[model samples]
Target: MRSEPVPAPAGDRRSRATAELTWPGKRVGHHAGLVPVPSPARASWDVRGRLVCGERADSLLLRADAGVALAELLAAPGAVDGGVKLCYLDPPYNTGERFAHYDDRSDRAAWLSTLRDHLLLARELLAADGSLWLHLDDSEQHRARCVLDEVFGEEAFVATIIWQKRTSRDNRKAFSSMHDYIHVYAPAGPKVWKSVRNGLPDEGAFSNPDGDPRGPWRSVPMNVQAGHATAGQFYTVTTPTGVRHDPPPGRCWTYTAPRLAELVADGRVYWPRGGDGKPRLKRYQSEVTGLAPFTIWTADEVGDTGSAKRALLSEFPGLQAFDTPKPLGLLERIVSVATDPGDLVLDYYLGSGTTAVAAQRLGRRWIGVEQSARTVEEFTLPRLHAAWADAPGGGFAFGAF
Candidate 1:
């Protein structure tokens, strides 16, 4: 098996905007050169009480090159076509560094080409509402975005979420780079994905102080910027106590005068400061949806590198930890947002198997592909075993090419 990245020969690097990203050895299709598809070795290992087989399973840990494995899956009859709900990729950032499990460095062209191939296959594998979340650093974030925009279409491009990977400062460098970019893309376009996308659990404290018939509720701002407001939305709002109020400067009421009257008549409006304050919309618990996920994720909310490393050490003492491992919290958040229970999640670059563990625990089926067999056996498998012990029911099948 090849351990190091295949190097690309030097060639002209000029690129045309209309032609997409041009690089040396850039191929038109998903397969990188002539890749020999390896047959899956039907091997079984004792994973505690969990079933370990080569047949269909709730989850799969395939030990093979991701690009080759993706091609094979795509070609399989009635498999992986519009089925994957979410694909979370934590591929190499190509920082030109060699690590314990795998080499991080690769030629820019080769790296981008490999990524594009995987993405192209992933696109085919994704469901109609499926989405891809790619974790990357500044090293290739811009270029990767360009590639995603091309492959997934510009309209399918979602938000670029900023994750604070660390909080400590690196005084030695010119700047202390602490955050990582998670680029999201939906194959069927953002609008389609948004309709099915899951929202974060609302952490707001709701209460019904007025003892309304709707039970517990929370108030939301009823004023919006007057950017494109009609004159009908600029009327005064009278409270139950006959206090008249106008829209604040540069802001207009969220609803028209008639609509506001209807809401008020329905007791959906709340007045603060003992019915003296400005009106707000009262949203009942049953009517309230989950909070929309934020573009910025703090390290505290999602574990950072230090916390992830510490957790690894706690799980497996005296083990050589991976150079970079994503936190379980980060994967959990992604899974929760992109998939529901029973939805399939794919992670081709399953480095340390955090994605698998997270998906399993969250009641989502997953398929992980890792090129390194030793890493799978030594690191990924054990972590999964521990995770399975806690949430037992479905067992994962393990095989290698």
Candidate 2:
């Protein structure tokens, strides 16, 4: 309900960094505040290593390990504050099933205890200009909202993205739930965030239909409102070729006379012989970023289970334990909106490693924290390697280098 948006109180540091990273020629950037381009191949505990950002970390996947235990991470004794633009924590929804390597179906008491610690660590790791996205369902959304408002502060609440993860409902009960929530929270105002614009529709709307050479375009209605004096409002517009037409009495042009003249000079208005005799504006596809996205994620825009499964399966044959993994498109949008090309993204739950895969696909650096060796070793890693197989740098080669 309450938000505190100050003007650049974060000082010259954030401004300098933003300018440096987004500058036209300065993009395709270097890793900043990293733990030194991870020599994690050399780090191996007796248990298997969960390789992330080309380095290994301890795993905590499995029902028994689901309880939050972050003494080591917090007891960092002497840690530094390298900023975090965004943090995505997708914890188990207490779904009563074993996912990947995690068995998180615990009793209520234990679950709340773990939840508290999870929120604690997330708050600690967050940057002042950064935000946190926690994924959950109706069962815990209200409860989680209370906890998050307390932790991240009620004022920090952004929008709750309702993602429709399915095409239809289960229909098992009177009303089945088919949607999941992607809750967004920021430490401060939205200065450090970016919104993604995807590729245009395939309708060829951007085409130079009239061969104007400027690019593709579609006819846009030039009249958006109506005038009171219908008779006086209507007037005839004649083309150089002698074609004539008049607008409706109440209708007025979208652009004023001067603006309409400019469009005519630019050859963007259509004056075909028609009943209304009104002019329409031409909107070039090249002139706009694809339509913006809404908070509700659907199967239509992103992919459904079939596409997601094939994407993972193609990379690692016979590796099929995790179900309901997100498609590249879903995570693709998340990464595009949340982080830049070189920012660090962390997804603790890391179901099928969608966030990590998306980061890689978008040329951003990322880390996935899952407790399951199956997910880290078998599921997440192989899929990523395959995705990057044909890329210029040979895509995501892990290890010392």
lDDT of candidates 1 onward, in order: 0.80, 0.57
Name the candidate that leads on lDDT: 1
Model 2, span 239-356: residue lDDT tens: 6566665555557656666667788998889764543445777777767654545677787777766677777777667766466577788778776666656555656677677777
Where model 2 places Cα greater than 4 Å from the true spot, the runs are 1-82, 98-100, 107-113, 123-131, 153-156, 188-204, 223-279, 310-320, 388-401
Per-candidate TM-scores read 0.90, 0.65
lDDT of 1 by residue, 286-357 (tens): 776677789999999989999998998788788898778889999999999998888899999998899999
Give candidate 1 regions above 4 Å deviation.
1-19, 29-56
lDDT of 2: 0.57
Per-residue error at 328 for model 2, in Å?
2.7
